[model samples]
Target: MQKLPLTLLLATVATTSAQAEGWYGSAKLNSARQNLSSALLTSPRVNERVDAPDNTKTFTPAFAVGYAFMEGWRLEGEYTMPSSSTFKSYWAPFNANVNSLDTHSQRLMLNGYKDIPLNDWLSFYGMAGVGLARIDSDGYQTNETRRFAGNRRHNFAYSVGLGLDAKVSEKVTLGVGYRYVSMGDVETGYNTFANRITARDEQLKGKLKEQNLFLEARVAF
Candidate 1:
């Protein structure tokens, strides 16, 4: 279409071509509690009597940095600090009680985004990126007397997200977003501790995943 360039340019009226090329920082409070599927509670091998479902909720903080180039493309890197969550599971005297675990991750993303004009004061955009995350995790059995596996493992990660913007001025854009993320299999070794008397690492949690909500602000150059 002859008007394609104009159409694209017009869509950014609320944003300004004067946007600069530099590093922008963002901090966000997640909207949803991430789902950490429990391993001990759900593993069928832990004896059917001990077999339940493992589900815990977590809220984590998110941060990111981006470099804008040619007023369009961006190279981004984001990180989510791990959160600790505790829950109880019942099976028997030997393997019944609470379990505590901490999870953390870092992501390197190559992203593509388009800015659209919603009005004189509003703009909308969507971003899609492919990235990998390094996930570190650890878990412990609730019993104070007996020690279960309290080991750590690392994994790969990936994500996708979308957002909308409210232009406060020619240089500032307020935005909100939602994202879906996944972490690859987090492995805890069978017997790699000083004392191999732990009972929590009887099985693996496998691939871990999560969903996050983000609120952001952008200062366009």
Candidate 2:
């Protein structure tokens, strides 16, 4: 099982500071929650859509690097390395299925927002960004009824985010945001020899919405 490299993860955060121009940077430690829609991925044979536990929590730590083009108007590149969780799916006899694939992701975002000062210590702003999520799935699938199931591969997904930002300090901000992400449809085997097919239709796929509660720290030159 290959995990995220420690050096790469640290470098991602280190870039938040030491930027130039309208160049600004931020770092946030947050709680990331996903709303997985279980109905859309159900098998046609399994008439009853069996419900599964939907809470996969992660210690989401991310960073953003943006530049103010003109006063309040800003544009930047954002990155978040959210740890991978067990991509679990359900089928008849094999209800609890997790093929060891270390499904992890990192997102790059493009943002736009306005910062309005409410008081000397309290400032607020609203922002929106498009997220490009990259995922790597390398797991083991043991199914007696499936053929050629589970492989090591990478998938790219995306999400749209809208949020509010609060300037808590001259160098810090509080953020609350919602992201509607395309989780895509996950396919599982019906039998040990039922040629396994797992495809994520970019268009018309299952959706997973994520809500993030975060705190950001910035350093202004």
TM-score of 1: 0.68
Residue by residue across 1-221, what tens digits does model 1's lDDT show?
88998887776653454234667766666654455554443333345335433445665666777776655456666666655543334445446445444445455555666665566676566677666666555454454443333445444466677777776765676788887777665533332332234333353354566676777776643
lDDT of 1: 0.56
> Which lDDT tens digits does candidate 2 get at residues 1-221?
23568666554433332112356677777677755455233334333323443556777888878776544456767788766655344445445542222345566777676555443334455666765666543334344232223322233454555556555544565666555555443333222333234433111013344566666675443
Question: How far is 26's C-alpha from truth in model 2 (Å)?
Answer: 1.1
TM-scores for every predicted model: 0.68, 0.61
The 0-to-1 C-alpha lDDT of every candidate, in the order given, reads 0.56, 0.50
Which candidate number has the best lDDT? 1
- Report the lDDT of model 2 for residue 208: 43
